[model samples]
Target: MSVRYAIYFAPAKDTPWWDFGAHWLGRDEHDNTALPQPLLDEVSPTELASITQAPQRYGFHATLKAPFRLAAGTDEPGLITGLRTLAQTLKPVALGPMRVATLGNFVALIPHTASADLQALADACVTGLDHFRAPLLAADLQRRRIEQLDERETELLSLYGYPYVLERFRLHLSLSGPVDEAVAQGVTQAVSAHIDRLNTEAPLLLDRLCLFVERNPGTPFQRIIDLRLQA
Candidate 1:
């Protein structure tokens, strides 16, 4: 089986952010537990489950380096060593209060204000760890739907094996997959209400880089370890 790993910013366990996301997604990446999702008035539990299927599989987190297979000459131990070295030079980023927002066709938690520090951290994860990522296979490239992306995105995809990085990256903790236009608004509102109920008003902090692993295709990604930023 081909394993894949990804670098991501996931709020620590025991925190409000972590609890809310885990419950909302109906899975806890930290423990690999299936959680009971919040019940919404307008959306039935079955329908909510259907809509959240995609993000639930990936777990609740914001992608930093994206997922990739280990490159030639690089192993999991080497990747961890590299991340530990990188973590020493990085500092935690404070992303101001977040709100549920629609990005294209999906809903996600997005920061109210942009943070250069967050962008820098994501850029570092993508470029600094490029040596650990194998070149994208033809099947992988096809899966990304290259034809849907613009010129710059195509170039980034070719260079980094994933587009939506560096210049094009937008920090988002996805809540659902592609939502139908008819139900998008309701889903967003429901998520926002759920967040409000949690009352997690403090600014979101990007304090650690979580190493998430998928043992094989079609399997849920799970958190393996969290490397803190010492700087």
Candidate 2:
């Protein structure tokens, strides 16, 4: 039997749906749901599913910390307590200007340039959560190699389940599924429209770090913790 585990800041269902529609459109065949038209016009249905499938068919979200398995003896409540303790010392980060771009096969809204505060928050999440992670599995090892992850990246991947962390981490709110080069340009433009609107305002204020978990591989991730950044 598999168990569930993750740490994330889940977007509230009504929080102005953005790029997620493309992913939803791509995934609709498997899990039919409303796709945001504003985004779909930019990419074909085929491309949407393909580009977004790897991360699991879900709506939009900013992954402060990627999900991970629990160590042999760890329990959920203990994990929650640990995260709460960490949140107490940190404050919300002010994201500088951001842009939307296609991250490899996946499409996401990324920082226009780079933001130290954002990197610091990501680092805190990865390091602070280390105590709760389960040991890396063979599959995890294989994935690290496939991604050509560096030492620090491998360490974080082994400890936190995602290769990109800290300085290497780029804040993104995911948009379509994985797509080939053929359709990537259009998807990027569609994503940019939404990103442009947000950029017009002051930099984004990241005040919360949330924990979203899944029971196991096939299940959708859900919110487990909404940790406010401490002052």
Candidate 3:
């Protein structure tokens, strides 16, 4: 019923991960670009397809603000302006060196150290733009598995519309969806190898804010804008 939008931190276009992940997931979120999967050694396209299918729709990125409907009176243009204003005030930092790690059944790239700057940025994104977010529907609450959450988490979910935030938020660039331990291990090795080859020394400044929109239900989110953070 309501249009959904999310605030996400995606790799910048020139970053190796940007195009590398795009081809791996076979979807370019910026322009909804699609490409055939590359020939991965020891990993077949079919296997890669199955493991990545879940995260593929969203493309490759970390969720800063989980998707939500715009608050009743809010409009897209206003939200965009509000986001730009917020970005301007937040300090930027590079992601630094990251390595592949397995969180549950998914493989992702996590920074060697938790950067306070990154945490502050994520916290601001969640709390700052919250007023523009419509309350979650009952079904949405159920989907979050509220019964399994602790008291504090339930409260955050009620106030913030998502449980993973504040203390719970883990900033990781996901590379695969759910898979068995063996498969996850394999994916982790594969991702690590790719990152190792990249050998990026400089950290990506976490200044740019991207607005991703779900134009319709069951549709892939597209990057509508890259709002720069100006001093």
Provide C-alpha RMSD values for all models, in order.
1.4, 3.8, 1.5
lDDT (tens digit, per residue) of candidate 2 on 26-77: 3331233544433367766565556666654443567766656787778888
Candidate no. 3 TM-score: 0.94
Tens digits of per-residue lDDT, candidate 3, 167-194, equal 8888887778887888877776666766
State residue 96's C-alpha deviation in candidate 2, in Å.
4.5
Ten-residue region with minimum lDDT total, candidate 2: 22-31
Output the TM-score of candidate 1: 0.95
- lDDT against the true structure, per candidate, is 0.88, 0.63, 0.82
Instruction: Give TM per candidate.
Output: 0.95, 0.79, 0.94
Clashes of each: 0, 14, 0
Residue range with the least summed lDDT across 10 consecutive positions in model 1: 194-203
- Which residue ranges in model 2 land beyond 4 Å of their true spot? 10-13, 17-39, 56-59, 145-147, 155-161, 201-203
Candidate 1: Cα lDDT at 51: 86
- Stretches of candidate 1 above 4 Å error? 194-200
Number of the predicted model whose lDDT against the real structure is largest: 1
